[model samples]
Target: MKDFLSLSIANLLNEYIFVYDFLDSYDLKLKDDELSKSFREFFDSLDEDKLEEKGLSIDLLKEQFVNFMNAMTADADTIEELESITIVGGVNKYGEPENVELTIRKGEVICIVGPTGSGKSRLLADIEWLAQKDTPTRRQILINGKVPDKKRRFSIDHKMVAQLSQNMNFVMDLTVEEFVRMHAESRLIENADEKVSAIIDEANKLAGEQFQANTPVTSLSGGQSRALMIADTAILSRSPIILIDEIENAGIDRKKALELLVKEEKIVLMATHDPILALMGDRRLVIKNGGISKIIEVSEEERQHLPYLQALDEKLVSLRNQIRNGEILNE
Candidate 1:
């Protein structure tokens, strides 16, 4: 509170729009010269009788302003800072114990691999729900080694997990810049315009074809839409755990997208069938019959093959671009 009092009124209003709104609520206005003065100095100069008439004193105003700021920013302070997520053993379709205990840490990529309808999505759902042996799988999810409280598990305001499904579509009529700006503003981000620009830049880097900020969100193609959401989820979302269901078919730079998410120190759990993507993970969870069947660590031997796999992937991307351009395949 003392630190806040020392800040110039202009600085406070510029850095925290809430401060401006707080002053506006009380119909408080300052002269241009007063903007450079510290809020404490300005308040000290106010007429006591006038303040009393408004049912306010210097101490009361300061107290109420602090409380207002706290209420406005409470969600930002309470967002969970995850260290690791633990998945305790659960049962399979046959009611057999999965006999698995996996702990995934921040900045670690864990891949989920299995045939379609073999429970990959179920595992993601379990984590998303922060299951406490309640779901049919009987799996338990622990955050930072302890079971998350009901508030953290059920509160929609502060989610610990952000899931990215295979399909991404936008129905909004807003332009790309407007859409991203809306999300940034909702999060109460400082320098929102700068953040929005960075998000759009990163999204373009991931998309197959670049789109302008003026383009309507509904006008974006499938790949463009997926790229935008991936960028948004990576940059603006406070959720520490990211669940991606098969990004290989998104027609974007899948590896770069994962790298961006991991760079943000997020715990990434991707359900992917692409061998290159599975190999990219630090460990792979093999799901079968509605449960985790095995956990395979990415071996050094497998790590040695990524370069080759990446090269092949690049060739495919090149051929894809060539086809999109209507060029003949000479080779």
Candidate 2:
């Protein structure tokens, strides 16, 4: 305890400079307090030789640093969440008025179905961007029944949404671990080793072929790429609402991807054409003529057949793989 109490800033600079960013984000400045003052003075008169002579250990420094940070940022609730998002009536593309009013709560999944150019993506964009009658759809979005402010709309750090678009192309030449590392570090997640491992594990569950940390991002197939991003978004992204557009286009496991996000208690809004994908939602909106024509809550009768549908989908995927491998079908 004496050695820990006497830990000098020189030791921290020499060995634990990586913690500087974490400290800076929480504004953990040293001042008149005994420990902070001592640390401040030690830093002011940093001496490498004296620091070593004092027998200060990196473990002690980190322990003190963590305690300081935890005390600094302690809140009744650290996790950010939205109670619900409500979309009020907005104008459609034909300059006609839409009479749609829908509310989506946390842990609920909603699917959007429409033909091409029918405004499914527009509705999603409205929810994501928090449209205040500003975009093409002229939609009014509310969070917890009130219009979201400009700070909530523009602040990237406090983002309310995460999107998984149709394409999952990897332009970067990085390993899987490196890519997850980049994202984890950006959020400054504590215990990265455990978190990264959990993310990789969850991603592997959704992908047909398991990929390791050393796997090159560019070499990952479409499904693997989508699965990786979905896992990353679910595990790391602070955004409570996750938007998926045509996820089946990436050849991802539609149910698992939806299940992953839904299980995380995130509000999932997806625009899809596949019946299997659409039926998975608790409720779905059907759009026609650039307006939400109807909202249908999925019945127990539909969910009853999901197991059969899942088996059929899996078999279809197997057939697809076999055909791609140049195996001929037997009639």
Candidate 3:
């Protein structure tokens, strides 16, 4: 607290714009020349009559300022770095033991494959809630190989997982740049403009059709919206675990999106039906009867087949574009 009080006004404004805005709320705008002065010095320079007129003394003003900043940014320091997540299996839907224990480390991609309604989403929910034998599945999830504290598990501010579903729609009346900047500001990220630009650029690379920074988020197609979100989550979100559900239908570059998340060293769990997507994972979980029936490691042959699948996917994308452009299919 003392250190914060002694910081120059310029330093405080640079690090916490909320402080500047807080003072502005009280109609206490500092002069440009006062930027070099510390908060304590500024308060000391105020006359007793002025302080009394404002009904707040120097000590009271400082206390209120501290409280306001803390209230506004309470969640800024809550998220912690993650190394791995371990899933201790529980019972299947029929009350039979699942008899599976899976550990996924940072930078690893695990695919979940099963017919629809096979409880794939249940597994994701258990991990998202950090289940401690409490959820319906009764599975236990351990963070960094140990059960997380209640604050880490239950606190909304301490998010440990990021989920990207099949559908992404934006309702905010802000441009793409404005949306990313709002997130960056909330995180108090330094060089926010540069970070926002980088995120948009990366999003365009993953999107099938490129978009400009000034483009309204509401105008983005499904693919563009998903691409933006994937890049934003990979770059800005502190969550270490990323859960993706059926990204194949998102109309974006699925491989590049996964690569981006993996490059960020996040633990990725994807529930997918696409054979190519399943093969892209280091391991695939086969679900049946609401239980993990089997875990299959990507075989050497499967890895070798990835290129052919990707080429075919590219051809399909090309055909889709041609059709959208009103070109007739040729023999």
Candidate 4:
């Protein structure tokens, strides 16, 4: 289910001992009055010959144990084959119905554009809660063409969406290295040191200024903090759905930030007003009157203008850097 291939015997026995109840029917007892040992002790003391003598098949037991482990550890809240997230219908601010149906799938960047007070944030909220036609918007969200289970809607550990908001404040007083190390340890990632190093390197690339791992997370600049969080989320977070609010005003380099954030298998949805971020999406959702008025595919003509826009952006970045360096604006 959740990668039990590396699970130890101790871990397996501790996690799902109920699966071993079938052993009693085969005359192999862990709770013998003579031995009076724990299940783990019984397993460790018994050899392959002893197991065979007790009528237990080694290969068959191994296979059955793996199957049991898979079934036991699999999270019922998560959908393995999430082909698409469909939004059936929603309401506008005027209490009018939205007649649009949208599907967001894996490996696609969908941008949301709208004026102030439009339902852009509301739409994101609906997706985050996996709404079931219950909210004010009256929207129904579906996973793989079916309504998501109630467990996913309320479960804390099994979040489908990983949201990256505009503001990220580190309440903990740990250094950047310590912060990342904690996340790596929580994920039980192999080579945590290597992964932490890589995350720091990638974060520096996104930030306008580089930050040292020894620096306190609170000491980091706004751009550095955002960059670090983006890197951390990309590498460590297990949530398959990546949602982003407007990040254009943030001091981080938008291009590298997007690169570090987008995953091949993730469903990336962002709400942005910046032209560059808007055009970065494969398609843009046009929000009007507090509803998704239209969906616009990136025009081929606009695609051709990316290079020109990028060149201008680079120039602007250079100017911004000069300003940040206390240099006078040149005519």
lDDT of 4 by residue, 1-331 (tens): 4544344434545665544554544455554352344334445455778778767665656566556556445654354556689998888778788897888887678898888778887888888889888988889899888988777766554577888887658989999999999888756456899989999998998888789999999999888888898888887777767888878545688877777666536777888877888788889988888777888999989888888888888888889878989999896
- What's the residue-level lDDT of 124 in candidate 3? 84
TM-score of each: 0.76, 0.73, 0.79, 0.73
- State each model's CA lDDT, in order: 0.86, 0.75, 0.85, 0.76
Estimate, for each residue in 92-148, the C-alpha lDDT of model 3 and write its tens digit. 899888898899999999999998999998888888888999988889998878888
Best by TM-score: 3
lDDT tens readout by residue for model 1, 124-202: 8888889999999999999888888776776555576788886657768899999999899777777899989999999
Candidate 3's C-alpha runs over 4 A off are 1-16, 19-80, 249-251
Model 1 superposed RMSD (Cα):
6.6
Better of 3 and 4 by lDDT: 3
At residue 119, candidate 1 shows an lDDT of 92
Worst 10-residue lDDT window for candidate 1 reads 71-80
Output the better candidate (1/3) by TM-score. 3
> Residue 110 CA error for candidate 2 (Å)?
1.1
Residue 74 displacement (Å), model 2: 14
Residue 317 lDDT in candidate 1: 80
